[model samples]
Target: MKKILYLFLIFLHFSCADAQTFDGSWKGEVNVSGQKLLLVFNLKKDSNANWVGTFESPMQTSLKFPINTIKTHEDSISMDVKAIGLSYTGYLDRDKDVMKGVMKQGNFESAMILVRSENEQSGLSRKQDVFPPYDYIEQDVSFQNAKGNASLAGTLTYPKGGGSFSAVILVNGSGQQNRDSEVFGHRPFKVLADHLSKNGFAVLRYDDRGIGGSKGEVNLATTIDFASDANAAVDFLSKQQMVKTGKIGIIGHSEGALIAEIVAAENDKVNYIALLSGPVLKGDSLLILQSYALGKVAGLSEPALEANKLNNRKLYDILLRDEPPKVLAESLEKELIRQNNGNALTSDMKVKLSPMLIPWFKTFLRIDPAYYLKQVKVPVFASFGGKDIQVPANENIYALQRLHLNTTDVTIKDYPNLNHLFQNAQTGKIEEYFENQESFNEQLMDDLTKWLKLKTK
Candidate 1:
């Protein structure tokens, strides 16, 4: 009888252990549009009754993510991870075996879900092949523009054969992006140039005016002013004996896309245009959308977000009224104080905001890419990433549809899993941007290659 009782106690102990426990690695998948991406959370319990883990993604080529803090109460748990330039937070299940919550960055938010992992496989499938290496030539040249004789600096990537070939000029979006538009340690323009050249197309990508080794001030320039620089690049390409001058095209990203539209409208020399994550709507609408994105990512309350939108609209109105920069700056400072609990403005924020508001607003208000896109007579290929928070895919497509351009000749492809920078992105806070290496959406590149082939034929 004593032996039987001891055995029964042992069985009860084992059953309790199995019933009260919740610990193990968890896996989840986020589906954006039609693209499926995998995410893994390796959760383990520590001595202090806390859970810890690491998040890994097969799509990220840079580094592994460490989960820093995890806290739990009776029926609720929270997890926090800090990687790159962003922070992620999520709420765990009552049993602590699953996580079903939202993730946040500075001003972005997304639904997050995790389940117990059954196997040790990594989150997403890895790519079997990588981009081929190619040789490149770096050059510094000057071009005549409406602003003056501005100096331009960039690298030219050519195929191994060295004969004249179809070429493309890369154009950057807004801000003071360098020739390569370096982001998160990735030079996308350089990468594209190398890829295209290896595939038999010559490529030229240069820094904008006042950036990198280029000469001039971009702060005083307008969208039309930038268009002149693109025209100069086209002129230079036209003169290059090593390039098929009539087959040269312009590939613009973001704000650069607007410039490409203007260039194609004014100059008939451009054979093709590729607009990557470009804006099709007026600048004011874009700003509102950007603000809304920021509000979501930042976790702003409904009231706070509405207030911010009102403030932004006020600033837009002031700018549209043509107020002097100083007056506008002062008004913005006052508004910022009100927004921030009456705190004084930081010098860095003030400096960054002052010169940026008037010039950018003026330029954005004056240029409507749709009008110019309607005038474009050449082939156009435009792409937008569905996960891109800065430029919403629906708005961009709607703008294109309104242009009523040759739908047959205009190609617009939306990659469901990509970001504004054309990278394969996971569903998370916008802060994930600074933490990952830049990657181009494979589908976008494939579509581009196919469209270019069709255009050249």
Candidate 2:
């Protein structure tokens, strides 16, 4: 689910800028997920006296962002990025060395402080540039399926030697993720590809049909339709001379994990499967848990949290009836208004809800993970983060245990400190997502490598 903070950040970035003189590097910090994250801002005054600035997180490049309006009265100054979906209403101190203000993003608001910095900021670069050093060939490939013309584009990493190697295909979770499922300046798939390839496993990861350089409309496709794309990837891997034909498998994360299950159930060519934070429960239940957790983390009031839960349950009830999308959308809007007087959602919320809610909920609510799990003849391994707010670990693990398939070959491990993206953090708040470096847990990666080695042998 897209969080309000993300939308606000986008809005704040594109807002119009007004005249003001801002000419210095400033630094600030916020406590997120129990750890303090450093945020740096560099503002410069142009010849036109317009203030231009860039926002930078630690170890990420400064991204150019415009201020919608800037006002300076003596030493007191203020700026706002209405386009970035963020507004800063604050005052500069008498000494002009500090700017203290409040930042409002959607319904959430917090205080912010900026202090002048004397030295040039370091450790700020694009996340893609952090990929482990490796030699690889980038390629654009396409294949046809029942879902119309579909294409795949990604980097194919190979080991130092030229001999045939064990291979794995990467599958991303929900949303229109690129080949790397890039988020918060991190490319987990690219990191995984480098690490696995260097360890002698040929890896094939590609952009979703409509993402990156790939072709096709993702909105028109369903999960089953996506499974076809994964199937095509498996077929492509099987035909590769450098990939052991009978040894190719899949490693899917979140929603992609479910797609992997469907592919493995239907295809004999796939030899092994790994589910990273895959859900075993129905889609509606998963959403409820996710909503509840997020609300708790954000310190939502009891009445507000209960209202959300009730509305979600009501929405699920309507979905179970398999009503028309239009009717369901109307009903959901009515319910939202009843709960929060139409003030609960922004325009973006209303626009995104219909398309995202109907089809996804319909398919997900009807899916039974065991149906696919029971049909899989290949070995399977699954893992979830104990602190995952998106997918409950206990519920998913219990469902996996109940599968009729050979439980002996199924392994479930939970990392207590990891978040949905497999990064270690003290808390699992979604807003803290962009605050940290993007990297997978070392222990989980080690365990997966070991299991793959054993399976190939």
Best candidate according to lDDT: 2
Give per-residue CA lDDT, model 2, range 199-242, as digits (tens).
78988888777656677755556677778888988887888888
The collision pairs in model 1 are: 107-297, 107-298, 108-297, 108-298
Show model 1 residue runs off by greater than 4 Å: 1-147, 330-358, 406-408
How many clashes in each structure?
4, 15
Model 2: lowest-lDDT 10 consecutive positions: 6-15
Segments in model 2 whose C-alpha atoms lie over 4 Å from true places: 1-66, 70-142, 301-304, 341-349, 356-358
lDDT for each candidate structure: 0.64, 0.67
